[model samples]
Target: MAGGFGAIAGLLGRPSREPRLLLVHRLDERDPGDPGDPEDPGAGPPRSLLVTHPRAVPSESRGGHTLALAAPLTRVTNAALAPATNLDQTPLVRASRSMMAGLLSDLDHDGRRFGLGIDDVLLSLLRGIVLEHPDASRTAPPEATTATRLRAFIEARHTDSRLDVAQVARELGISRRQLHRHAPDGGVAAMLAERRLATARDLLAAHRALTVAEVAERSGFGTASRLRAQLARRAGGTPKAIRQAASA
Candidate 1:
């Protein structure tokens, strides 16, 4: 968003029920009226695909033809979609401009909010590039433990009350049994509850003004009674006790 990005449009997803994937192709002079301006006419063209986001306006070096697709992020359960670092390549990037022209037949697929079923395919395309580091893949490929990915997912999404063990397992591309097989001693549910309780206590200590219910909501506990019960069973006797201890 800073210094007028040249063409980094398809690089990241936004916080939305459905991420918008923009397929970009080059345009030529003979094309119809001005396709419209690039997101940053001054910025360079995009390097890799982002989850669900608008296409950056094609740069002067590359003409602009965009195909937009939308699908619920939940529909994509692949661990690769969790994160993708920047992937900048040539030929495949430059000489590859024309390949996108093949998808024109499905242009009608553009702008529709749901039911195209390309979500998995789109995210999977970047799996190798995203999950495996270029420098390390050929030698010692880094395999993230299931526990690591699960913890990262929950850390990012715990505020959503709907989050549960099943959803976390799905996000990690594993079954509930597989998830438990790799879980710590107390198992997945205990891990999640611990995360929530940690957040609740931190909020109580840091923001003395927040109510027990507010702390519960922000910490993913869903209700003050739930927060209190956990605290009573765990370390904190109460939210007030936490704040008082912090002050002391």
Candidate 2:
């Protein structure tokens, strides 16, 4: 009986080391140490449970290709492990756990050549789990929708010299105080200035023909001197230097 108990303990104690591959056609398996690197991993095998963030593109680029966007599982793991017996009983959690168990069993039986369908299912499960994670308050801001909308609106109108806190608040259909709630970091004026500066940088980089005054006007700085001052303070160089570097 002592020998039997020792064998049981050993069986239960082994770390799971089964190799797994992602189902995406051209993405390679992840190396955990360098997992967060932005370089494309290329078509190789897949590593299990590696989360990667891909940049958003224009609406035209949404389909007919395989892509994934996720942060590392470690970002939400602690929150997921929080003691929540009541949450565990929820149907969503129960279903996710059941599906995960089935996936694991299949991996053990079929030796890891999972189909794309399996990957899609697994990714959906992970997204659900991350969104419902209890410690999300500490992990990511819960008011992301407002922040996203605010940023998108700002990007669209950063070229308007009249784009101020009042304008932003009007565009977002919220009061200045409500907008402040969305941006707790530096406040509305700072956010607007940052967006305008970013627009100025993009303009300077893309159009070598545009004069400093033109770039300044188009980027909503209204005056070349103001643009120069902003560049000196925030961008660390003259607009001419920025354009020259981009051309080179």
Number of the top candidate by TM-score? 1
Candidate 2: residue 146 Cα off by (Å): 1.9
Best by lDDT: 1
For candidate 2, the 10 contiguous residues with the lowest summed lDDT are: 18-27
| TM-score of each predicted structure versus truth | 0.46, 0.41
lDDT of 1 at 162: 79
Report the lDDT tens digits of candidate 2 across residue range 54-117: 1212222222322222222332231222211122233454455456556556767877765434
**Model 2's lDDT to the true fold?**
0.53
Off by over 4 Å in 2: 1-144
Cα-based lDDT for every prediction: 0.54, 0.53
What would the per-residue lDDT of candidate 1 be over residues 130-241, giving only the tens digit for each residue?
A: 3443431222126757776676566656756678989888877899999999888988888888888887888888777778898898788999998899888876498888
Measured with C-alpha atoms, the lDDT of residue 65 in candidate 1 is: 39
